[model samples]
Target: MTGLRPDTGRQAGTMLIVFGVVLLVSSLVVSAALAPSVGAAGNDGTPQTLVGSQGGGPGLHESGSVYLLDGKETKWKAAETDSYFDVTMLDNGSVATGFMDSGYEDCEPYESPCTHTGFRILEPTDDGGAEIVYEYSFPVRTRSNSEVHDVELLDSGEFLVSDMEYERIFTVKNGEVTWQWNASSMYDAPADPTTTDWLHINDVDALSEDRYLVSVRNANQLVVIERGEGVVEVINKDENGDGTGDPEVLLQQHNPQWLNNGSVLVADSHNDRIVELHRNNTTDEWEVAWAVYEAEGVPFSWPRDADRLANGNTLITDSLNQRVVEVNESGMTVWSYKTPYVPYEAERLPEGETVGATTYAVNEDATVYGNGDVPVLSLLLILFQTGIQVPFWFTELHVGVTLVSLTMTIAGTVLIVRDR
Candidate 1:
């Protein structure tokens, strides 16, 4: 062009170098901004790749699998059962689980009646099969698809079970209902009775000898009901006493446990957080004493359970994330285990407790991906970093350099295409 300018080649080379440098710097910034958000463990913040094997930190005895730390560990896991909901290791070295076989499709054939819900207490044998020593089943009060999401064996040889469709908690002893608290009258009847589960009570925990903590998920409240007096104190409820009013704190919560320090630890499920609420002695109101939502780059999604361990760490079941993490008081992850399937709850077994010799298979079909897969926040951070760099490059770089760099990029692309 014009007898081929002598400096054209040198100018083009400089522009290309500037363009490449800009891209490299932008990439570095983006990567640095996103790196810390990945999941890690321990106080040192060391990144860990979670494996679904036995042998690590404390064992997570969960619904579908058992993860342990000893090399010579024994594990006993059963195949998926019908209506599986809750599982726990009993003090007597047995396992108890709740089952409810009712849903919308389950009642399609039987219009007026449906399948019942039940729980079983089993003793794990040395060979890995469990012996059903005790079992109980119950029918729904209304002809709907009632389910038992939680069950606990009382010290008095009774059972405490949460019935979702019925919106009630039943206390059964000797396979007979000793006492029950009905929550149907608390809220107005839903417009669609056939499909609506009004309260959706998901968890029940014994606070003391006479007090019980109930997690009413749909109602967005935790109630401390005296064994005989019904609801004694309602946490996270509107002070105006309106059943349809907005929740003060909780939102579609799950497990609620009483801490020794007169605080209640609860999994605020829909809010994607775990919170501990303590009653203020002076104001006579529930106050958020402590909470953990997103900590040290790991975020919780629909967490269903949070158990405070003896070591002052909190073992949390990040349900939607398909993983469980143990975090210290400062919300730093000390240990973590990723599950191939969604885990509803996780508990740390005592030092000598073992699940026996079995490897429970994860339901590959039921696995739900959440924060652990392609973290949304991290992607957004990358985009934000790139956005900030664009303005910086335009304003900070010389105007001639900026235009020349962009032109050279476009010319390089055109040259490559023409050569091809």
Candidate 2:
């Protein structure tokens, strides 16, 4: 009778306990192993929640309403059609954003469907609305290509636009391309031939009235292109018969920004770093001064746009890491935010400069929030326990499993974010 008994309640209870324990243990382990090797800004040494959806307008680094128009939706904001690439604040309190609008209604009132026009400089209106005071467009009969990536107010109305694809740099004033810098003229093939990945053109920053700093990603090089009316003088090499120049030797870089002190700030994307180059930066006679990387031990997963703050700090967009990191000159991460989605660019708000640079990290923190009942670390430990998938997600690959672990860890992370 004892051997041929029905399934007992005690045995059933034991199996349930065993299964729950094993499942939980496995989840925590997977989560811990694949947790982002480095912690995010405002993390405070604990796994914090990823907050806010990507592209939502909020100030992650300062106070005031700010939004990043990621080229996809700037049209809705009246900077119609152009996908925005770069933005900067002008000396007169207006903001200049570089974007490409398809059906551009130009300052000269040129025509519609202008095909990838230049930057749009927006001035603040008295009622919180915006007015497009300047829309820089190429002059008629001007021989140059289309498409621009960045914009900076040259004076009150003059500006610089980095026309990346066409390999041209356009100088604008009161909505006209006054002078042009042809990048194709300097190179054998107008930019060392596009890499198999399709582009070499990147960020461009002004050094002075006649000199410039240009980032060519595919070539993985940064060189100065001297702009003059009717000619673009390039100093690629001092190769033949003279001590005239240093061959624009390959300096691994993607984006280069300018500092007021004649120093250049560069974003080394592949290496995940930002460098500072000075010496001959302001006018001609420019040379690299020093280099900085990923805010000391905090390696960025994929750092993109960066800026040097007036208070001696650097605001960096750790793109793939989905965060914005602020590092003081001492290399301490004074602030950070593990935003929920990719942050392509970060700028410091001058009004908020007393707190350092301003940045708006796209946060997605509450997507998978956890209740306080769960122990954050324990939840993490269990996710990665098996070094495999937790099975609930229906994947077999360890990498996929590892990703799930990341998700769980983020869930626990958000729980502690506001505290940080």
Candidate 3:
């Protein structure tokens, strides 16, 4: 109502949907124009309290700092690679990722096929230099080639990497592919497994040594695959307490996770809800422990990716709108922030708050705030979080970004008021 007339509420509602589209178009134009002055909140001229500042140390001077992936921020020394696609930490405190061939913004140009490359970075080298444990390339057309997007390190020193274009999952041991899971095999071996087009293989996590919780975008399927010899069974959710496929489907997922209690968590991106998928009292069904979305609560425009930390906070990438939110188990957003490059995805800082994290090689560990200091599964909180950021004279940029974000705040208000 702040920007509308109730006299024509229905008419106004129709216009608002159209307004969303126009606003989206204008977003790129206006936001890009203000990019440089608003890229990352660095220094802020007045030393704003950034949660993730470096704790300080040699070769590990990147404590509380979060980098913008532009190869600039001092936090990550990009000796090579254009932009970082995905990143995960190893048990030895090292890191690895599917390094994109070029800087990722929106998406790669149609003509330039940015090949997905695989590489690893080892820290605390002898001369204060970071060493490369291994850098390998995937086959362009093979089932597990081209882009090795997400990697999950198994307890046995091997890792499972999702192959985006290939519609497959490969297991890597010391930088070599030793095993693979193709969609065709999982789906009764159709010649063209691309039917599912599960376009974005965003996340993969270990349910156990042999099973995984994989996020397949197109099929909207969150599959739990059993890797015992050759086993493929669909774990159905039972909505009724009777332990059978009693009722509703808990999720249509974009990202799914297994909780500490063995209950499954599914990020239903299309429906914009994070539904808890778990077994019911009966043997054949599952129930939705909880759901967070427009219908349930958060009313997210596009909730892309999410992860659960040991500390009970869930890091979610609110992609299209460009924000990352840390929500409590009760669905209350606790610490929230957004960044550019879609910040599309984020990995937990290597260590817990007690672990030393660096920002551009600078060391300063005065305070510890757990995942509060770290960031990003992807698109940071506000769309403006990405762009050319400067320290002073931020009056205009702040106002503009604020106005745009009012849309988000208002939607929530509308929902609340309407509910009552």
Candidate 4:
């Protein structure tokens, strides 16, 4: 067999590089051509929906914002911060939300250029703008996965906050932590909790004056802690008593809603579905009472929030899909709004996330669909990197383009090196 001469190899390498560039450019064009229509699908009466985006992606918190939509039209927006999480409109017409911002002097043991994570109250202006009227935030070491994700204004004039930095849930009254519950008391603690995302206790809600619901996301469990007592109950409690919860039940859930009838609604993020769990009074077990795997003819991709409206409809924040959809009990998309970025939580006002849901029978045989299969690329882009984003239209064609481009680029470099 005759070997390729240096000049031939160099020519082959150049041709391969050109092919890789062309494929990449063509893939982007195809992705844009297949993008979903960004508007409401049907007239289900858009009821003043508020959305909280967890920044654009990973460390790109500057792309985050809290905005209001009236039937796909933005009414007012609060985008002057780095990142935003849970959002709720207070009784006095002010919005209370969790936020993160960079640039602080007091980083303490960390260093300069730290981030501050806490809550802010925004008041709407007459000019269709919003202003931060009050804020209660503190500096932290890092920005990624270290912000307060949920905040609830208690009736006691205190703010219930989920502190992910220290893996705890506490209430702050006038800037002082009135009460706190640490997850290390239950889970196996790391050497220093703040250095890594351990429990990732992202949400805490007051069920009553003494009772609270805490979402321990990394542990795949939700906990009910009383003011005086520790964990009174644990949903998805471990079977072998290892403290690592049962993932088959919840699986890295977020923003769980405690229903009035002793049930719980959860955004099962890793599972890509919205599940409602009802506690069995007889067996003392939580079972999947209702679950919806798909809407608008597509399976959910990293859904982070689901709020059951008073009108028997469920509003879902389909995170990776970059849209919020309201679905009926039959799993049909009634109304939808395309968000500018991946949203963490959403609420439809006047009767936001009240304790209401019609009982639904679980359908185990229901077909489910998720983001298109691009196994190797998916793990790298969608699963690992927090800053990178994969479009909903990223189908097998895009996957093929990406794989071929990468191979050609690497092969071209090798061929050129041999010629040199």
Candidate 5:
């Protein structure tokens, strides 16, 4: 019996060593299979393959400038000092951007109650720089330049701007407010006097010549206001009357865009999702017809804007993730662009329109890759396919083996260090 015990111990130790070796081999195989593809998928000073293959033009140009909002002060100083709050590509190939001199800083030393906030329209020159054809300035009470989140150029040569501090949306034509709507009464003010940004109206879209769609972020609602009338319709309204905007469908949302079908697509920002609120024909109530939370198992973080493209796919600015992802109708990420700066909005200009010649260079050091020539989504799909097709037991075994290998590797390295 004593002799048998020693044999059993030796057998058990041998089995453990064998299992550890097998695990190491399996882990190496898995790593070899995945690592190369991922490394090759990086920008690596070359264009990446087009992801999702929706046939959307040349994707993002290799060295073209986009009308982007660089939200970070440090990064903006490194890139360009003319840091903007909102940038939009005009139909005429020009770009319009909203800028603040002090960058959301308090209006101090100037002695005025307003900060220097303004908009500029730049026309592309032959030398890859823009020519500012027009400029307009305004004073906002808030310390943050976020008071104006969007600027739209109308066919009538007017501008539609959102002012959050005073909770109002106004139109400026010929440097004057042609039309304006005050939403102060619709929202409850914060208890603290210092908190001037109460409603935090982050977006405004001109639905028609007379109507508009505005996203009240703090209210957790989208209000469609007509020029003459007050609030016409509210999406995600406080139906329960709890005063806290209870059961809020959209929590701290932004960029509510009106669709051709009379529905609205909103970036449900705080909820970390994009939702399309469709108006019911019978009940006249707005219902969520479509949503894209996590496409292809990739979740969004603080997405600020989402635009439905001409091809029916949704172009989203996954802000906190520092990336822009284009998801198809089936919720598959077909295209993505990793930006160096925190992107606040992403819009696909019409086929012929362009944002002119200003090109923001890509940061090669950043790991996330997209907007080049490589098909990253395809590689992820290969991994996903392998995961699904493999037998359950085999998959479990591979995972177990990989874990065992990892444990042994760590233990061995520790032992070697301890012995030394």
Candidate 6:
């Protein structure tokens, strides 16, 4: 084997090391330069907003919170759990949301330090805090995909909950199950739905006293269920006999808002966009009326909730982006607020999310935001982002820089070893 002179090898190694450090530092500077603004602090006369954060990871790994915000300022906070999911502001000024926490007893089928999942009603105090006035929870074997992801207060004084543990949508009154619609009845039944994440029924919204809109996330479909009757209608129905629905229509979607009888708004989570679908009266099929892929120049990173506000704007919880944004009909961001870690859902106060707005129809060739991301790099970044919180400004440029830095560092190590 041939080797370079001692001084030459040392010089090359040192130069490579210096270049690697410079590239790494430069990437950090670029990331800071591209950082988003803290956003409008209620200056736009936006109403108070309620946010549910799902923390950084699964149960016991990260701590989540439910908070009330006036713009970017936290007016009240409740952070006693591992994750906080769907949130609703009640008529009496209290908030109802789903939550998960660990360190509970009677964790059967699993080991000690198990998790509990359920819904709680929180009342805000005058001292920038909240107290859980009412709670109804149960122990789960595992933390992932076993929590109650949504809760709604019904007119009959019962709580409608989405139970992922049993793969069912049920209403509970005074700790008793009043009613339930199991997924196995409609879809193909698994041997054991509780053993794995079978359906991931994450959301349930009471459309009427007896009608409910349910989001079957893993199936990539939403079903409208009427009491006593099974699935009345299926949006994004699987026509090809496949177990999952059409991804082009919806893929692992969340928090779908029923906007009138003809249209609906959904956060197409896996597609990284907010989509508005209108029922084609002629064909009786749902079509994308409008969609936005990005807001405030940042590509949406796994947006989990989108609500069509009463003021014709849409409130979106951009989960991985760690911000909530309100955008006008033209896809222009009207107001934005930076949040901490990952946020699962957000709602604008006072008017909240009311049904039926003047649906806007856009041309088929309307402008849509697109981020020119490399395919493999984008996937890697997404996996990293879902597991850990990445900075909003960490873009392809940063990825490129980091890769170059790693290559240089490896080369430097090789050179030093050869010299030795």
Best by lDDT: 6
lDDT of 6 by residue, 1-420 (tens): 976866787679879988998988987887788675645533645678999999886232377899988756789999868888999999999999999888987677678778989999999999998999999988887778898999999999999999999999999999999999999998897898888988899999888989999999999999999989979998987878987888888989999999888888999998888888888777887888888887887788789999988788889999888899988887888889888768999999876666665566743533344453311237667756767666877766676787889899889888887887
Give the residue spans of candidate 6 off by over 4 A: 35-38, 41-44, 57-61, 362-377
Model 1: per-residue lDDT, tens digit, 1-420? 354356555565556666756865675566456544322353333222211211111111223333222212225544334335566667887766666433333444355455556677767677765666887875554423366767787788888887776677888888799988877645576664336767788888776656778887877787878866888887766666667324446778877767743467778776667777776667766666667775446556567777776666677777555566777766777776555455566666662111111111111111122232322223333233222322211221233444555677777555444434
Expressed as tens digits, the lDDT of each residue in 233-257 for candidate 5 is 7877677675434333577887777
- Candidate 3 TM-score versus the reference: 0.55
Please identify model 4 stretches exceeding 4 Å from their true place.
5-7, 18-38, 43-45, 362-377, 383-385, 395-400
TM-score of each: 0.63, 0.54, 0.55, 0.89, 0.62, 0.92
Alpha-carbon local distance difference test for all models: 0.58, 0.47, 0.47, 0.81, 0.56, 0.84
Q: Is candidate 5 or candidate 6 better by lDDT?
A: 6
Error of 6 at 418 (Å): 3.6
Strongest candidate by TM-score = 6
Which is the better candidate, 2 or 4, if ranked by lDDT? 4
Residue 302 alpha-carbon offset, candidate 4, angstroms: 1.6
Worst 10 residues of 3 by lDDT: 353-362
Instruction: Put down candidate 2 lDDT per residue, 1-420, tens digits, no spaces.
Output: 344234344444445445545555586566555554343444343221111111312111111122432221221132234244456665676666655444434424335434444666666565544677766554221211234556665544467777655565667775556887665554445233222222346566766666667665554555566654433433223445342233232233544665533445666565545655444433554443433455424345446676766656677776545566777654567666654334446565543112122221112111111111211123333333222212222222443445555555554444334223
Off by over 4 Å in 3: 1-83, 102-114, 122-133, 139-146, 188-200, 232-252, 260-262, 294-298, 350-420
Off by over 4 Å in 1: 1-74, 101-115, 129-131, 139-145, 189-195, 240-248, 351-420
- Give per-residue lDDT, candidate 5, residue 279: 64
Candidate 3's clash total is 52
TM-score-superior candidate, 5 or 6:
6
